[model samples]
Target: MIDSVQRDSSLLVHFTLKLADGSTAESTRNNGKPALFCLGDGSLSEGLENQLIGLKVGDKHAFALESEDAFGGISPDLIQYFSRRDFMQAGEPEVGAIMLFSGMDGNEMPGVIREISGDSITVDFNHPLAGQTIHFDVEVLEINPVLEAANADPVG
Candidate 1:
């Protein structure tokens, strides 16, 4: 192992995300491919990335993050009602099923069907892991320190 991970360094790590109940929610180790990420990149949330700082190669650690530190708690305003007719073309809307709906920006946004009331269907746009505590288990496999601007090639 070299030294501790520092800002701007690229890291290769295996991580597992689990809920309080010990049920695995996601894992990169299972796929046999370690995740590669550069510090300071937006790919990871600040809260989650902060937990990785100072870890060195071959280090294993777990962090517990509250709902606020992880994904924010569910927001009631994110739940919306849409007429049944609007979703007939896509397919049947079933409770607990996640579907992609066109957002105001014309991009697709995922929402889970929470309830059905006659002609009205309620969809919740909050993240599936919102409002919960998460156990983040990480193993740092490799760390590639970033070269200074003066020593690095802008393009190769």
Candidate 2:
């Protein structure tokens, strides 16, 4: 039998994330390709996955998630300060600039520049949606069932 977003199923979908005031935060519709992700993967938050579970192909749903249920409250610790000299090679750092920095694990981490002092630059590494109530709108286009190995269809 074919799958339709049951447990552990991979899904190709289109999604829009909106803020509490109905402003679009992010959207897959703007991108050329639909997103593909499996259930329980880190691609989605647990609250979001809970809402998407059991949805069948071509199904559309909207979920209103609270700040805690969404990306969770922003942490003050995630805001860090760096020396102005540290950004010299990257050009001048300004407020609201999102820059990619290499972490200890060698992964690219994005931090938004929030303040610029005479010698210190404040950067926030928190998720952009953190501490905000967000609306998740999703449309499931296709389902790919996975067993020990993934035996799925192309998302064309």
**Candidate 2, 1-156: lDDT as tens digits:** 555676677888899989988899989999766788788767667777788788888899988998888898999999999999998899998799899998989999999999998999999999988999999889998888344355676798
Give the Cα-based TM-score of candidate 1 against the true structure: 0.85
Task: State the displacement of the C-alpha of residue 94, model 1, in Å, after optimal TM-score superposition.
Answer: 0.9
* Residue 20's lDDT in candidate 2: 81
lDDT of 1 at 96: 96
TM-score, each model?
0.85, 0.85
Encode model 1's per-residue lDDT on 1-156: one tens digit a residue.
448887767898999999999999989978888888788977766788788889998999999899878887899999999999999898888999999989999999999999999999999999999999999999998898343554756685
* lDDT, each prediction: 0.88, 0.86
lDDT of 2: 0.86
Q: Give the TM-score comparing model 2 with the true structure, all chains together.
A: 0.85
Question: Per-residue error at 15 for model 1, in Å?
Answer: 0.7
Clashes of 2: 0
| Weakest 10 consecutive residues of candidate 2 by summed lDDT | 145-154
Clashes of each: 0, 0
